[model samples]
Target: MGLDDDIAILATAPVFELFERDALRLLSFAGERRHLDEGELLFSRGEPSDGGYVVMAGTLALIPRRPGEEPVKVSRSGLIGRNALFRQVERPADARATEPSEVMRVTPSVMSRVLREFPDVAAAIHGGMAEELLDLVRGLSGVQERLTRLSPRKR
Candidate 1:
């Protein structure tokens, strides 16, 4: 795909929607394209995460190492590993291509450069992270409330 096409795809994602057209263009330019055959491993759990992948075509299965958990399937135009944009942590799960797949790999260095150059992009990313944290907190509060109700209290 051309630069404009990549930018258009990036813009479709909520996280990238905050960025300007020029920023998206820069991201598309910096990103590396990857192709995977069916059943190929994209990344394994415990591997150091240096970047995130944007699934441009086909499906990727996120397989949990823990027993009893079902693998989560992500399809075209989906964004994975958003945390990799800032965090230097090990991958939490295995990602495999469920079919012939195409992805755009955005490295942390590229993201850092963009963030450094564009204050608006950085602010938008921070705001998005804050919103996500708030949602997580709200979910945890609900779970705590339910647990409290289920448990008997002593006078």
Candidate 2:
């Protein structure tokens, strides 16, 4: 695919949508592309993840190590290992291509450059993350309030 195509695909991902065309162009230019055959392992659980993959084509499955954890299906334009784009971490699950797939790997170093070059994108990400955390806290507080009400009074 062309650079424009890569940028279009990247733009579909939530975080990348905050980026400008020039930022996307930089990412497409620097990001590494990989092809996966059907049932190929993209990454294994416990492996050190240094980057994220944007699914350019086909479907991939994220199989969790924990028995009860659900597997997630990622299709075109889906971004996996999103957190790893910013920081290196151990993979919590195995990612395998369910079908022939193409992915663009965006390393933390590349991501850093994008953020440094695009302050608006970085600030938007920071604000979005803070909002997510606050929402989680608020939800937990509501759960706590409900639990307190349900509990029997001290005898």
Candidate 3:
């Protein structure tokens, strides 16, 4: 997509809507846009995550696996990983493309500046993050329930 499309998507994005134009401007100072094909790995579990992604199009899947267990598909989204823009840590799960995808990989510097310069943007990001976290908790709860149901009981 073109810059106009990017901006439009950004403008409508929950995380971007939280910020001011100047905070968005900070993104101009960092990172690059990247396109990925279906089945491509955005990142593997435990990988050192340097940035976060904003989905421009297509879908991404979060797959979770435990030791000696099969990988379980957890959640999918067209717009995700926005928190990676601000987080400084490794990803716990793997992100893979379900279709040809376009995403904005925003670096920490640009993200930090946006948070510092635009309170509204920060609020939006926090809200988006809260929702994401809740989604994750819900996902995990389902997984745990399924696992409990499937596991053999000790009697």
Best by lDDT: 2
How much is 130 displaced in model 3, in angstroms?
8.4
**Tens-digit lDDT track for model 3 on 45-147?**
8888878776777777777767665454322223455556777777878888778876777777777876777777677767877898999999999999999
Tens digit of lDDT per residue, candidate 1, span 39-101?
999999999997988888899999999888999998876888988876677999999999999
- For model 1, the superposed segments whose C-alpha errors exceed 4 Å read none
lDDT, residue 139, candidate 3: 100
Q: Residue 18 error for model 3, in Å?
A: 0.6
Scored by lDDT, model 3 comes in at 0.70
List pairs with backbone clashes in candidate 2.
none
| TM-score of each candidate structure, all chains considered together | 0.91, 0.94, 0.63
- Write the residue-wise lDDT of candidate 2 on 1-155 in tens digits: 88888889999887898889999999999999999999999999999997999999999999977798778999999999989999999998999999999998999999999999999989989999899999999999999999999999999
The TM-score between candidate 1 and the true structure equals 0.91
Q: How should the candidates be ordered by TM-score, best one leading?
A: 2, 1, 3
Ranking by lDDT: 2, 1, 3
True lDDT of residue 77, candidate 2: 91
Instruction: Using TM-score, give the best candidate's number.
Output: 2
